[model samples]
Target: MVARRRRGAADADQYKPEAHSSDGAVVYVRVQEDGEFVITDDDGQPYDETELRVLRKYAGEGMRDMLQQACDRLNADLSALATVHCDTLSPRDKPAFQSRAFPEPEPQRNPLLQPTLWSRIWPPARRRLEEQNERRAEQYTRAFSEWEEAARAFNEQERQRREQETELVLTNLDAMANILEEHLGEIPWPRETSVSFDLGDDASTIAIDIELPEEDAFPDVEYTLAAKQPKVSVKKIAATRRRMLYRDYAHGVAMRVLGEIYHRLPTVQVALISAYVPTLDTGTGQPTENYLYSVLVTKSQWREINFKALANIEPPATLERFELRRKMTKTGVFKAIEPFDVEALANEVGI
Candidate 1:
């Protein structure tokens, strides 16, 4: 699958002079250097001049639709952070051996029971039949032996696979980490998000560090159709609103990581998640990461949440139920805070 774009650049690039039919039919179109619309058919031939006006009328409407779509995409991206879900991993059934049935033996005839003189004279026919039956028995025995060997090798491979699945289901630290890494990569986040995991002493606890998007990463502009032409009018998002969005985005990410770990690894009782963004240190002038929020989520407390109604749950409000550490103003302006020390906190909590 193609990765989703995190910025508004893709939308901006699509705001060109393109048109479609009023019935919502797709049209191949491009604007020439001379500022003329060139509408083409599936074969790339230009449409007749008589059909140009009808197609051209919907140009403004199409561009307006594109702008509205871009706005909708931005909203959906924000909502996705808090609505992340994972399917539980279960152990596979044990492998069963499939036995190959042996072939039936051919019937034999006796030369002495023959009533015809020709049959009595051709006694070699009975000998040939006996020899053929012997060869058939030998071939069946050899084939069955080969089949048994192949079945043994196949059963061994399946046994190993079943053992690995069982270990993962039981939440072995290494097995959980390996499978979790694979599952995390398959999530379709709007941004290119990356997370690292570590086992906390045992399988009961896991620590996660998530790379948060920058403050300006959230969409800061509202797009609309202009009054005059097939163009979009831009309105800047208020400073306070943008700040709130960034805060929710960070908190949502923290909750998402916690939820994923608890859901995928049922034996994991606790999770330590920290959300951070890349920044330059003011004093040292070196690149560094500034943590926005750290949270310690327990399975018991997490179960109280109505997972079925995640769409209505506000990430910031939901996080209040957990052990969270953050420095933010009432207006949602976040300040850099030190991430929680997972090992020390786990020891203190006696987990």
Candidate 2:
């Protein structure tokens, strides 16, 4: 900025330059990864917490006007230099500058590509926009035509369906009337005490459902029977299920089985599996001796155990302990330490 003043009757001028972000304290602006301007402190760390008031104070009002003035002045200087380039610098001083001040003159580009700003841009841009609009209009027209065609096709299908519905109703009418006649033909129309035909909502081609009045319209006894239907159906489904109730009840069962084979049965240890598979057994006197790989439980041996994890419930339920859990014998028959029916337990508990 330049200022004029009169001092001692002589005119004087003073100039001041604006401060930049990198002026002092190593404070500089950098573009962050998020594409926002970041003001870094002297230590090279990004500003942590900054107040808008402090920023506003630094980048005070009318800052845009100051920037605009700078740009305008820069443009004016560039314009003057531009005219110099056109009239004098293009063929004359450029050669001089290239020859003396700088050595290279490989046909440098025009200082800034031309018509200064707009003329170089308008022609190609306008042509491109026109072409784009033409393409868009053609696409829109084609889409509209396709949409209209589809709509017409759909409407024609609907019209055919309506005609088919009319024919179906007409064809079914006589049959329906005959059935009604068979059911109520003996009684005169007015003489019949109460005659009602089941009516239905608008139906599709594949289905017909009677729009019966709501359950509230029926007596309480009928509602009770309907309410029991779900429970009865669930009971029937539960009765058909074939699953051991105590299968998941035991903890560390896999570890127990591993311990039993590794610690109890010495020949069937982990390393001897292949040896056992290929060798003959002394007890059976055959390579393929019949052995019980697994035991099946009889209904009497099934134990009632709840294995719902303790951590899930409030305050946790006390874990129940039972001695000598009943198991199936080698014959698949059950030997129970205590007698109990396990299969019907879940239904009894409403689970």
Which digits, one per residue and each the tens of the lDDT, describe model 2 over residues 34-151? 2233444546565555532453356533233333333333233222211211211001111010111222222322232224245347887666666666776676667667666766
Q: Go through the candidates in order and give each one's C-alpha lDDT.
A: 0.61, 0.26
Model 1 clash tally? 0
Scanning candidate 2 in windows of ten residues, the lowest lDDT window is 88-97
Clash pairs for candidate 2: none
C-alpha RMSD in Å of predicted model 1 compared with the true structure: 13.4
* CA RMSD of all predictions: 13.4, 40.4
Candidate 1 local lDDT, 69-140, one digit each (tens): 544443554445334432222222232222333333333332333235554567787666557667777776
In order of appearance, the predictions have TM-scores of: 0.62, 0.19
In model 2, how large is the Cα lDDT of residue 254? 17
